[model samples]
Target chain A: MSARAETLPATGLRLPRLGLPSLDALGAWTLALIWIAPLVFAAWAAFHSPRDALAFDITAPWTLDNFAAAWVAAPWLRYFFNTMMLVTTILAGQLVLCTLAGYAFARFAFPGREVLFYLVLLQLFILPEVLIVENYVIVSRLGLFDTILGIGAPYMASAFGIFLLRQAFKQVPKELEEAARVEGCGWLGVLWRVYIPAAKPVYLAYALVSVATHWNNFLWPLVVTNSTTTRPLTVGLSLFAAPESGVNIAVISAATLMSIAPLLVAFLIFQRQFLQAFLRAGIR
Target chain B: MSDTDSLDRRRMALYGWMLLAPALILLTTFAFLPTVTTVWQSLFSRGTARRPAEFIGAENYQYLFDDPVFWQVATNNLIYAGVTIPVSIVIALGMALWANGHLPGRGFIRAAYFTPTMLPMIAAANLWLFFYTPSIGLIDRIAGLFGIGATNWLGQPETALWAIIIVTIWKEAGFFMIFYLAALQTIPPDLREAAVIEGASRWTYTRRIVLPLLMPTTLFVMINAMINSVKLIDHLFILTKGGPNNASKLLLYWIWETAFSYFDRPTAAALTVMVLAVLGLVAVFQFRGLEKRIHYR
Candidate 1:
């Protein structure tokens, strides 16, 4: 709002004649600079050698010591394996559970359904973090503590997943499902052949979001797992990067980069689809 | 046909219940059960702040009223939300503006902005901690270049909360902007086009047309931002640990401390209920504000 003072000429064509009113152009330039700086700095620290990274000088000697030192600091391979197991379990369960729950809520006629649905929506507000202590007690009692399942279990029935899929399923049109049923297709067939395909985009979007979110989840894993054996990438990476032991900036950035490398690489490959998914996540 | 149809109808109802079993059970056990347990456990007693628990009516609630830490934590949440919400929303609004224009490399810039929001607080917190480290880290070194001496960010009580607020904004702003970006796209192109036809300045068009169309998104964004302010504290474990002196301690972190650290699970439960109450009220107002502005058409 502050950027426009001289470019309005009372015509739609004026914008082209004016070339973005100068100030807005400058404002855009400045915002881009501020937003991009930290990640660029992280990249510089990650790729450059330690001496170059640590040197107060802007231009200095660069080498591969930072990456090498960062790599040797801990067993990142194990952390990656643990993260994979953790994410796969959570997503796998969410897919099955959310689809069923979503389909039921959307299509079925049942008693107390609205009340049950209302209670379910409340989960979206009272995130698991608020009730972590109670959750800890449950996980401990179940003998799931320190197991990958413990890390993935509480998140298995995602309210967000159910809600998103429900929205998609409700839009699938009742007539189509009825016709399929009349044509001798079973209910399962209608779901698999009709509802599921109709909701594929929502499913794809939900999958992207679920993976991005759970992959980065920390508190649940921290509460459930103690040892590196079960700790996910975030927990393991934090242990190595935390400042309590006085970590150096250069080495820590290298570790941070290595940890996020998979997700970051995935993002680079499916950048457009990922951004579109978030855009469609509908302000949540 | 009639007999089989009756059987099929009956079976479908049974099948619906079967399908809902896993998700309904899991949600009830994990989410709904804990919420109910928080209220139930809060009412029970532990018999002397140091003993095994028993049912005690409202005693924990009464204690919360008397406890000085409750007020302190509430105030800290206010401060955290106060800074984090507006800063994030404004930054997001600004980010959206920047990207909406024909800028150089806008896509790459948007990705850079949105990167931190993509990371779970755990991973992102590690990256920030490295940046905020005392002597050789990025923030201090930049301060050094400006002739300022290195200072401990998370180590001190005075700067700790502010430090957390800054990082929280850094992580969240871009994510909020994605909503704004989507909202911006939906604002009728004709409104802007008509405004330009009327010689409305770019600033004027945005202030009057774009911003209003985006108000619902803003309200929704701020509500989530407020809720995040109250809770998102896993990152606190690695970054501030809630303090050298509880300076950076947030409400939920303190609840965590009370539950596990002090073994005062009853008080923690009471505190959890209080936190939920406040969040509920904020959420109500947030949604109400959004509903008022929502242009469903």
Candidate 2:
């Protein structure tokens, strides 16, 4: 509408221009600046000496010493490995469990299906975080304490994943399943050939959401894992940057950047995919 | 023929149960059974070196009702929710409008707005911790230019929770903006054209046409924002540890401290039950109240 009003000039009378620069654009740019300032500051402080970082010297010499110090201060490589293992374990578990459950709900004719489905949906509200007290006891009683599996166990069967995949599988054309079955495919073969292939996009969207979530999870892992061998990057970064450790600001910023760098870099590279993934997964 | 039909029916049922077993076991273990156990455990006394575990019905609830710290933490959480939810939603709407419009550098602006959501809450806390540090903190340094003296942002009782609230808003607004942006794109362009032809002012168009159309999305976002108010307490672990006499303590953090830090298991169970009750109320309100409104619209 604004574009049409500007270009056509159909009316003889002229109206005042809204502004020299569009106020909408100006406001957006300002907000963007405020939003990005913390990240920009982190980058600036991480590259310079502590004195230079505090001084905000524009012409100061940049050095890698902060990164070196940060690396030596914590066992970051192990933390990274742990986070990767944790995310992979949770994602793989969720895909298999949710796919099977969703397929059963979407296709099977069973008694009490509606009630059972509602029970599954209840997990969406009663998240594991809310059940932390009893969940801790359950994890320990299973003799999985202080292990990576303990951290990943409670979240392996995701209700959100099951809900999404159920929606996707329901949209699959019935003829395709019958065709696969007619070609001498059994139930498992039909699922592998038809339903799974049809729901690839949903799987991808759910995978992105799940990866980002488990990668950033902190409290449960902090409770379950007692050693550096199992602590993910977020918990490790928190402990490393704790004020009781007496780490300086420059090195702390460097360590913070290291912790978030993988997700940050992945987002920047696949910005469109990341945005679309959220939109797809969230709209339901 | 009848025997074959019955056999097929039994086989189908078996397949269904086999497929559902894994997810049902997990959900029961992690979510459903734990909720029941939390309530059950709250009825028992915390066993220690001196005494065996015994059921003491309503004692924990009575204690929680009388505990001053529990009351204070609950109040703090309410204030935290009251401030963060509305402020973040409004900012997110503004961001979505800008990002969805004919703005210069739209891609960069949208990305800049959303970068915070991509970063972990713990990392965000680490970055902001530098900003809130007294004297040497960037905020104090900037204020120093105007001859204002250094003020303790995180150390003092008065300013600490507000400082945490500011960080929470910063981290969340961008995330909510994505949902708003998605909704904005789904709005038909013809509605704006019709409003323009009718000489509706921009504000009027937005107020009358756009907002009503976005009501469902707003309700959805509101529920998400509510859930986040309870979920995103990771930053507290880094920033304050609910410190300065528990001025910044939230309900979940208090639960953690009670159970893990103090080894008061029954009290923590009671607190957990309270948190669950609050969440359940919100869920019921959303489903019964707001959902009807959305459907009517």
Candidate 3:
């Protein structure tokens, strides 16, 4: 109010520019710093000796000892391999299944199509996590329990992916599909030749979202997998950093940061695509 | 020609069903069948070596109603949703506005806010575990600078849930911000200019012109947040294990504890049925609300 009054004293008309933009900037930066503080603190502790980490010694020399200790403390390499496999498997299955279903919904006129679409959409709310008990039993019955496939199976038929691809395919001009059909292409050939190419951006967006989701996923994997060979980074890290493990703070920090390093680096490198992908996915 | 066209139509319908088969199969096996099985299983009693499971209609749910831990966990989850959803959405709106505006280093600020979303929840909980560690933790160290004594943030019942709540908000608000930012970009700059031309203050322009346009995105983010509150409990495994007398325990976490840890599948199934009921309500609400949004568009 004081700033406004002072700025308006001459002509009694203060434009928005002279008001509190700078203060708003300050608030934004402050919140940003607070948002990033945990990561910064984790980096600080992970790079320093345990005593130095606890001491808040800004001048302390950074070392790799914590990383070394954390490395030896767990089978993170195997966990990483499991997570990569899990994410890729889910993406592969989702792409095939969603594209086929989405193409059907978009281009084909079939009895009960509306009912089937609504049924698929219902899966969006009745997610795998809520049905963990029965899913666990089902995986066990299929003899898939304790495997990566077991962890990935429930999520392979992604409702969001199907929905997004359906939207993408619907936007394709009828002329393109008709032209492909004129060339004597069957449904599969036309879908492969035209709709799939047109929906590449949607594929990337769905892939990014799916990989991030499954990579960070913990609960289902934690319940399904028993050994280090199948446990993803999240489950491994949880056990590694569990209070019962008695690991030190710096080492735990090192392990935690290492677990997220791959996804974090990919996100940083493709930051624009990541943001755009999420934006596109959300707006859908 | 009519006969051939009829043949083609039948063929097309057949191809469509074939195309949908794989997805429908997987969805039924995982989603639809599990839903029915969960409800059915909830009605039966937990089986044992000496006693085969028997149907005990409404007994498991009745037991859940009588269990104090169940009540506490349900209440904690409600508080979790009640606080995290609105608080994150409001912060997300502020973030979207600031990030979308002319703030310097806006890219870096936006990235900073979103980096956590890329992180695994367990990793996030591990990072917070350090700060919430008593005395030597960062929060206490900072408080120490102010001559304040140490406090156990996660070890006590009173602060444990609130501590968990803060992590949830920090982890979620940034993700929600992306939706708001997307919605914000779609708003025409001409509206703002016209408002300014009418002598509207910045606050007035934002309140009148900006917010109402973002309602659909708000509802979208709210549904996402609601689903997240139910599913995103990986941090609980790391931070509290719903510890210090079950203060921070959420329904899903308790369900996990019952089914896996205690091997009481019947009770867990009952709890899941309740969660399913809640999500069903959300689905109906969302579909209806989304239909209205589409109508508006």
Candidate 4:
């Protein structure tokens, strides 16, 4: 634990204290720059005219025309709305279903519980994307084709969510639940008051992960959605910049920026919190 | 008293079933049912307007086995997985080591490494599209500096999949880095102090102690990277669409095209079963072979 806090020593007990510290820092910085270069280039290209963008001119005049063109070229606002609804619907559904299922698996000693739990765990391997062909047929058969609900429905019952919530709930002290029961709370009441609150951090962590995941999800939505009204930002961006569309590189960059802006902005703003949330989620 | 206890047990069972019902229903509908149906469907001939579906046991499999495109796509997927998994894991480990050390602006470096993971693969693809575009693109421009003429990147079959592989490695390495970072933080500092007391070289200490400790993380990251190589085809949609005579085509993308684009459902189902089998094997290997050796604590 103490080692966890120690900022790894710069030049101690390693390599005879050669003046390699600066070189290491330089290497780290260079790698960081390389990692960020694409995004930096995207921003630059997105803000400049196509000619200037192609010319790689640092002195190019900045303009919003590319964004304007990108905005008018597609139904981006509708796509954004669809994505929001899709993620929200999936998140809400996952919360309810996973919470109930996780609680049962955590606390109840029912026959076949272990088998059922393992069955649910199997979903961790059988991702919805893997079953897209049949799922598409099922969705169309159920008349959910091209609908936001259809796009999100298949992912609503997340195995990862159930697993995470189960872990969180199991860690909760029994005394709290007993105390809630002593206050005349029923099972549901105790769950709502005690377990859920105790697992607030876990919920927050899962929510961030779930949102980021669905927001960036593309293939299933692309397959399910046929129109602008149903397509999410990722699918929309893909179609908008598709080679056949012949859209200029600048406009494509601008549209790419627009599509990723919300999550990207949120991520940049809440860098520490976002990273902490992911760490707490323990996805690996 | 025994009767009352039995009744209580029954009640608890009922409550548990009730709680599990919603998740089970959704999972069955989406995952379990689809898996079974995909396999079942693969054994039948695809239905057409003029001809109703018929039993065609192993026919679709026979066709897939004979299909050159299927072989090509499978080979491409193998190469994709083979390259992306090892490359990303290595780069991720490097990123983790850098970020975990006393580097200047570690937070910014870490964030920079991770930002690609947060972006949609579509957006990343779009950004890279311009970079890979020949003649007018960034790569060609950079190459021209060395008197090298334009080289078609995503246009050429030889370079297309490799280009896509690079983008995936960039996108994935940062994500795996976080896992390594988490694992790194757990190593006790006393070990480092003891190494120093023993006058061990940094390389020797890292190779002997740190690398060994990170083996579990490496395996964990490796499994995840393997799974991701199979699932992550989003960038392909924008980058190449498995183009250049299906040179860059992967199994999933090929399945999508066969089913949706060509309306060849049976073939797609057959391909999907292959995917499921691969994934099932991976799951078995992970759970049975590796799980025991993984040092969770």
What lDDT tens digits, residue by residue, belong to model 3 across residues A1-284? 66534333211124335455676678889999999999999999999999999998999999999999999989989999999999999999999999999999999998999889888999999989888889999999999999999999999889898899999999999999999999999889999999999999999998999999999998999889999889999999999999999999999999999999999999989999999999999886
**Model 4 stretches with alpha carbons more than 4 Å out:** A1-21, B289-297
Assess candidate 3 and give its TM-score to the true structure.
0.96
Highest lDDT scorer? 3
RMSD, one per candidate, in order: 3.9, 2.9, 3.5, 2.6
Count clashes in each candidate, considering only residues at least 3 apart in sequence or on different chains.
Answer: 3, 0, 0, 0
Model 4 chain B: worst 10 consecutive residues (lDDT sum): B288-297
For the predicted complex of model 4, DockQ is 0.68
Relative to the true structure, candidate 2 reaches a TM of: 0.95
Question: Compared with the true structure, what per-residue lDDT tens digits does model 2 show for residues A1-284?
Answer: 65676532311112336666656667889999999989999898999999899888879999999999999999999999999999999999999999999999998878878789878877877878877888999999999888888899899888889989998999999999999988999888988999999999889889998999888998889888889999999999989988898999899999999999999999999999999898889887
**What do the candidate models score in CA lDDT, each in turn?**
0.80, 0.88, 0.91, 0.89
Which is the better candidate, 3 or 4, if ranked by DockQ?
4
lDDT of 4: 0.89
lDDT of 3: 0.91
Task: Report residue A82 deviation for candidate 1 (angstroms).
Answer: 1.1
Q: Chain B TM-score of model 2, please?
A: 0.94
Q: Write the per-residue lDDT of candidate 2 for residues B94-134, one digit (tens) a residue.
A: 99988887666889999999999988899999889778989
| Fraction of the true interface contacts (Cα pairs closer than 8 Å across chains) found in each model | 0.46, 0.65, 0.78, 0.74
Worst 10 residues of 4 chain A by lDDT: A10-19
